[model samples]
Target: MVDIKSWIFKDCCLVFSLLCISIVGITTGDQEVLTNSWLVELSEGGEAAARDIAKRAGFSYVSPVLGSDTEFHFIHNAVPKTRFRRSILHTRKLKSHPFVKRAVQQTGFVRSKRGYKPLKGVLLSDLHINNPEIGQLINDEKDVVIGKDPTDPLFDKEWFLKNRGQSGGIKGLDLNVEAAWGMGFTGKGVTTAIMDDGIDYLHEDLKYNYNSEASYDFSSNDHFPYPRYTDTWFNSHGTRCAGEIAAARDNDVCGVGVAYDSKVAGLRMLDQPFMTDLIEANAMGHMPNIIDIYSASWGPTDDGKTVDGPRNLTMRAIVKGVNEGRNGKGNIYVWASGDGGQEDDCNCDGYAASMWTISINSATNDGQTAGYDESCSSTLASTFSNGKSTIRDAGVATTDLYNNCTTTHSGTSAAAPEAAGIFALALEANRNLTWRDMQHLTVLTSKRNRLFDPYLKHFWQYNGAGLEFNHLFGYGVLDAGAMVYMANHWKPLPERFHCTAGSIKKEMNFGTNEPITLTIDTDACKGTDNEVNFLEHLQAFVTVKSSYRGNIVMHLTSPMNTTSMILSQRPNDDEHKNGFTRWPFMTTHTWAEAPRGTWTLRVENIAGKNNEYDDGLFREWTLVLHGTRDPPYHHQDADEENQTKLFKVKRMHDMAMKN
Candidate 1:
């Protein structure tokens, strides 16, 4: 009666579908066992059907996946004798359901907070005290004025807000929030959700602006997202980040926040035993309509070797948020560039390099790159973090745990929140700005000012669009005043389009010290619906194998002769078993450049003087260009536009003649 052959074929299909499930060795209480949790993606409008299917399958229905309408998380209490049998049976049962589209068993992955660890010589306590010289510097710079400055005790020490050569720092090398504040834009009606350990919402400085409706604790499955108290104060990170964004002004608490009037919500998902894909998805997708910005200061291990990013559910949630969130205006996601220093490359970390996120880098108050900063082309802009000098308050001043305050908040973690707060101010000025619009504003409004690579390893160079960018500092440090002003007068960018310019599927090999240079001449899909005349972001999807992955380096040269060091040397990434497979290495260094010329990519392995390893294989390279046919900026000259139109008409005529 049972067709064994047919049953086997069906079971194979079910197994393939279930491959979406992330398999990791997770041990619970010294026993390796499944979590008994399943993430199921059902057909649209299939909630009632999902519930009925769950009941028939001897499972209990959980809430809808927080950020997804068609996905739900379900639980099972039945314990079969063998985990493999149970998994197989459950996979078949879920697949048999007419409403269930896909199902995956949730597994755990290690997600690290991007905070900087203690350096060998730096004393954390040295950052807690304000230098007496700072007050004198502020007083001496009377010409540099902010209207009716906040009276918070630490306001003067908040040099990132208004740098004036304090504590061995350069003058006017700050976020320029004062000018925006003077213009009366204090992030009045924006909400930014901090997805981290937890926020000390009850703190005096943060309580007034804390948004409970947008807060959730996926770690404990509750709404109260308060940090768990500990003697080590390990969970004070989220609180410090919150204060950087929405700490109340003139409250005599800590220094005033960048957007002191903005609302801050806590999404505590990191303080758990192990992180799951569903948890990450829920945190990102939670209340996207209500929460305008999601500030993430964490990612995969910054140890230079680990290459990890969002899993299935989390990836879908992020896509959904950008496509459907904020009433379809799009949710702004600000991510901290990795803190792997010279050892790690942010491009290897998918979250920071993703096109969906605005990857933020850190600059010191002295207008130099921090010693621990990673060099990557994906970095969009810079924000002030701590410096190496102990002579001044080298860390960010923000609220800490248990109604306390600290002046030592450091790392790209601190830098990301500052950008989030600035974006909140811009949002308050213009609520209709889309996610892409925020990025465009960042590129247009960021300033070079005095930012430079102190090591001189990376120099600022002008792209084809005449926009200066560097691997270390991106477009340059963020100018809050300029950003807010631009936001007020900004028009929505044209509908975005992407064109796959070229791909090389054949594998090629290169010897040590001998570089491999590949070229792709593309018209950027001319005379097509997906034509991208102006470039916003360029991605090189590469699949390569190396004996020592860390030694591999890549350079992408745009048609404008602007070269972007997309993949930098990582001394710590020695992963030999598996090299990059279809990893999308992105770059903002070529922003607004034309994508219609000969693009050159140079891949090399400089294995030091010893020639340490054997040859590496380059399997594939695919170039994708994202932009609009029309120029996105008003600064484009009339001549350029005339040329673009003429080219379009000529190309169309030629195509018609061919037809």
Candidate 2:
């Protein structure tokens, strides 16, 4: 009964206003501006007092009541740039000022984040042919069907399900979905939403399971998220992705979904050529309660050359979904890591690189990392995609645009929806799984990809617990049988625990040649609610100044003697005159590691064009750890009320942004 869409629009309007006011120092092509902005958190009192403080400083104030009460934003503009920064500094003396957080700029990416590491020998063209071995396999093994499954007359060619090796793919390299199906978990009762271009509900394979009530088209401003792709090969993307999630079984025209009995909706939003922060926020927050899992296969350009992610508005929406959707059980967010393997890093793109998303990478039918896929420390697991090497044109077979069926759908784009269907199966097994719980199950159940991996020696890192990891393959491929079994028996984890280190502001000078290291003691995580025994995610907020930002590199080391390649140097990012402005570099490499000692963040100015303009400072850094604690702190559904009204960002936004 609640008008959730209306609420989100109001919130987006609020953000637009705030951003318009908060961008005090940014310059347009024809303008020269001198302004300084600050994100101020009040020690006490209401927005009126904060506005009064802003008035006293002769500045403008804007408060976007995004669920938090103690924070407000202010801007002061003046000429003589020095006077701008100086006048803004005066707010630090305000009696109500508790924490005056400055935004830090940052850049760089780990190899996985950079999407630069390409598979040994792979091509870009998508092959539309069937498995090169399908014909031979049918003759040699007589049991292999040609056109469709014996039970579902139209599903026989879904080699990713029937026979992974039928076309020369690795034997048993598939997600092992058939084994789970035998166990009677067909993904019934669970629902998924494809947050992509659009889905063809009229397709014989997907119409039966389409849930229109939960769908919307932000791009065309309609509730029907139908495919509008007319002449291009790309328009079928969303339909193909959806078929992977909930294509009807037995009543099928194409291969069945990973979760055949599961319901799916297409919340089409990405139809246009350009998008703003508001459009994305609307798409992400659409009917959060009704949609159990949101499968998104898009993110900032994976060109491996750009570094960007969801701005403040969209991030708040994601946090809101995780904390409030699914009747407080939390919504599952399955994301495509990236398809920019040849040129970009997934870590450089905030969405796939965030600790909050289940970054799913692509593994080919032969069980190798896809050449076009991005690698990253944040990738939780992987799924099947087009085998780019021997099987250049072979892709996942699913329903296509015009109510058609095709075998050419590929990329991390296809991989994510497959994972989403798997998630639906997991959800059906245990509807109580929270977002974090799902992440734990993913990490615990995913089996290491022991296929013909060439980078095993270089990519492999022992979690010190015999559990192996590598940014290249995450925890390896998704084992459907393994994940579903674990999901059915999963005992909920303790409430989320957290801790932070090195909040002190410090300035470090960097010469053109020296590498500097900053250490912070995480002793605060001993036994409090913030204690961290095993890390799930770790973040570093940083600000830097550099002329050639691409020349910088950074790393973080744990007390356990493990090192994380947080930032790998990027060469193509030479066009930027700015360094990181409070950009967060995230890593999932701390898996199973304890956090109770000294942690180190190291920065090296490997090849900057100039340090003579030593105004560049390693301003300050804060290390945050999100892990687990025993006897979980008294749980409360603080975000529940937010479903009916605006939700405050509370501590999330304060730290999520430069504030």
Candidate 3:
């Protein structure tokens, strides 16, 4: 057999070397040099000539492989060879010039190109008061059983019934289900997709509420949603995550979910080598319908570095979904920030670090304490196991796949899904809200006073306010109650207004009842594709009209197309169906207020369709209406100036207009 250990060590060395080079280059200002930086091959024939030109240009690093290309990072400072000389000694003919990639421009860090590591471990007994070993660890003398045991005499078949309470089970833990229910979120009609190892659908606590219709097995392309029999160690990690989000309660069982009534759908993608990409593609294929909130507990190493390769494809797909997929009826993508602390050797924070998605960090049971058991010195506990288990006092508790009720586990991984469950509740409470609306409300509603200290010392200082939205706690442990309040009442941001036409030669008649237009001569719309055309125009001149007294709000309701219409009826079905077929249409008439507020008009494309579709099919239009105030204005803004600034930002919106 091949030496797996040696191979891993070699890969580590490669990563270390690249990291060192990047660090050294950045620290020494040598990053400005072309030779010392990462290089990308533009053309084959230009290899020798490019090298000579680069050498003459004082460039250091050069690579022919596109995967190894670093040209994207330094594109801002890169001097095009054509701008310089033409002779053999001073100039070089080009096959392909090093073009900068978009990621580098956006993030400044080079993406890692590493593969996935399959989880390997066994299922242990639930670590509760009943387990002597666990009881001793936490110094508990009382006997407490959090879940049911298959071998126990009290185990009954009727207990396995859907939505039934656990009669023979211990009165273990309460996941604050009543609070969630009171917030108007029962998770009814909502689906949560779990991307992790295969789930034991037969587990008593999970079986009742398990969604047989939504579960999918990406491990072997089989229709069976459960894990393969050969994988003897199929633990309860996925199952526990499911329970944390939607486990039924009230029948005297151990625990309950934040959204107990929500449906749990499993998508197993963590098993086998290089399965991450496959899982991501499968989830992306589902788009806006199959799943609403994607709860992911597993992530890269805790070292806080990114990796590249096919896995990037999945990241790209997720970003695509966040930006344009689901017809702008965006789905919430939740990722566990990782349990590793600053001292962990592997700097492996995965998709969480990406700005495209929301990263969830753990908090202890009090809903206020630290969720993971950090070392005395603030490092990740060395004994932390990635195996299937549960930890109760740490604020997280769940069932084990082995059917033994003797074990409990703790980790940021567990805490992440707990938050995801709360998000499910928020979604259920307010099904009319979009993904962005939900996320902003959650972050804004989170208490800044409850901020958790990060393992990396720098995060606290680098992140302002030391409260809301630190890289460590990520809006400080999601507040389900607060989120629900905002979800049910919050409104969408107003569409910003700008005059794309150089000057309105005609006194724009924006209707007497509409909001007035403040014309400014800034090139805000210049060079932008945000222009409306009667036919085939890249840009257009338009007016935004708003009514501040009616229930019709100018909510950008669809991601696929842009149009304007009047809502003459309540609960209109056309509101959901009028948008592009690929995206969910924003329900515009649901606002509490009728036509009254500031509205904006600009030129942009309807992006709800897939990239493969013809761009010509999308058309732009003018917008006129009124609606509710921006939801996050009061919470997210530090003051009135900040609120005004947010209001002034005019995005080239191509939202499907509501009728």
Candidate 4:
């Protein structure tokens, strides 16, 4: 009988595991449920009414489930159920029903009113389709063909100096190579992987920066990574993006790049101007290499819902890389937020909405007067470029696929690579840092004040302080120097502590004056000396019998040493005032002042209702904690050696796990 019981338990465990796996697969799909519209609950007397309404609306499907007394679950198609015209009518009619409670539009799939239109002649044509027109415009005009003389006032000498003269800046632009180099983000030894259309690996300006050993043409599974010059058509979008990210610097040749010292890994997944899911999938499969950053300047149109279709497989693969790929040492995934800000809401959801990806928005040059010039009240400008003179922020000078130096381009696609280049600098600063830590630090330390434009109030509404994280600017504009400061001192926050009396649903009896020790364990604490100040990163509160009146004591034990006893009384009156200080809970204190290691927190109910406590009298209380560490300054000096060692260790651990 005992053996039979054991077998039953084991079978139950297996079933539970399978169920969990299935749920994960569903929730993490590329087409995730974005809105709660498809969820509905039936009332006792309204069951028939709800079904009739759904059927009349042409939902084609429905499922029933129990919920709150006033709410219930009526599952239907996860996507919008009503036709465009019907949806308008439904909204107007639903507003009249008192018992209907509420009706919302579901968002599980993207709804596109029109299909994708490929770029004519540009991406689909052979050879240079615009060559004749360009030739006619610049016939023997050396200044127009190349640029104004080196002494031209309009020439960007600052840009030239900053890019170390490798880029073709306006003749007199002063380049600040010293300032850029002083920041320690030369992009040396970093590998940036570009997942887009094929690039011209042979382009003179970009050829020196290409990591030929690391480059791949996933679109055709061939050795050629250049755009095919068939007939009169050629698409060099990918090549242009690559050049902007890491084109060779100080070569005294063409255009400059953000990270001139970085190596470029061109991974072609788009053919000419078209995107293919199959090719993306194939490219994703080969991405588990030593890549420091993955830059993708493409995304579906943000249409208020998640995109679905077979192409979703590629997104899933990308997420896998974010969560568990590269042997758990997460890789940074950078994506262009989108270029649909003109008519569509900038916040529309898409691949960039994924928590695993860092979404990049665009900004025009400090001088450009036209284009989508939304104020940067919220997010940071990761990079700058001349708008529309070249291709994709065209004014930003960089190597062209055809080796021609041009400047008319503008789009979020161009902006993302600029951000990716800055990230490469941060990575170069400290390679031991995880991608999450890098992202959080970058956002936290961005130049919020510099990007704010007080002239635009509408764009500043969502911005937290007319400084950081605005709806338009995101964290204000990106600051390479500030990012460097943060990288040198960034740290991860402490994980939240789960304080429960075993099961939340199960009732527990604690008689009045009966001292019960409620133990708390934080899942994120590493219990290592390096993480000793983990507790300093969190804030917590406790309550007994629904009243937040209690005394909490914390004790820590570790291989290094034991912590001194500490106590916190309930009802802390001190409001969180200091920018760097954690808020004091009525009954909470930080661990920063305490010793690090394995720790236990005990909450004692000092006073509350029911002197003779009953099991039903107990209620749950919420605890909130926030913690992070700044990267150490010494890391900057020891970046190369420490980074190499850490990378090897991580690689070995990953290999062992796979074995």
Best by TM-score: 1
Per-residue lDDT over 159-253 for candidate 3, one digit per residue giving the tens place of the 0 to 100 score: 21111223222221123333445434677878888877667777655677777777767554444567544453444567666766676655334
lDDT of 4: 0.43
Ordering by lDDT: 1, 2, 4, 3
Provide the clashing-pair count of each candidate structure: 0, 29, 50, 77
Q: Pick out the ten consecutive residues of candidate 2 with the lowest summed lDDT.
A: 104-113
In candidate 1, what are the lDDT values of residues 247-364, reduced to their tens digit?
9987667678999999999999888656777888889999999999999999887777777777766766776778778988889999999788887788877788888899999998
Tens digits of per-residue lDDT for model 2 on 105-217? 11111111112111221121232222222222222121222432324433445656655465557666778676566556789988898887788888777888999998888
All models: lDDT? 0.78, 0.64, 0.38, 0.43
TM-score-based ranking: 1, 2, 4, 3
lDDT of 2: 0.64
lDDT score, candidate 4, position 268: 75
Residues 234-334 of candidate 4: C-alpha lDDT, one tens digit per residue: 35567767877776654544545667788888887655333333345445544555677888776544331222222333554564465544445467778
Task: Indicate whether candidate 1 or candidate 2 has the larger lDDT.
Answer: 1
Better candidate number, 2 or 3, judged by TM-score: 2
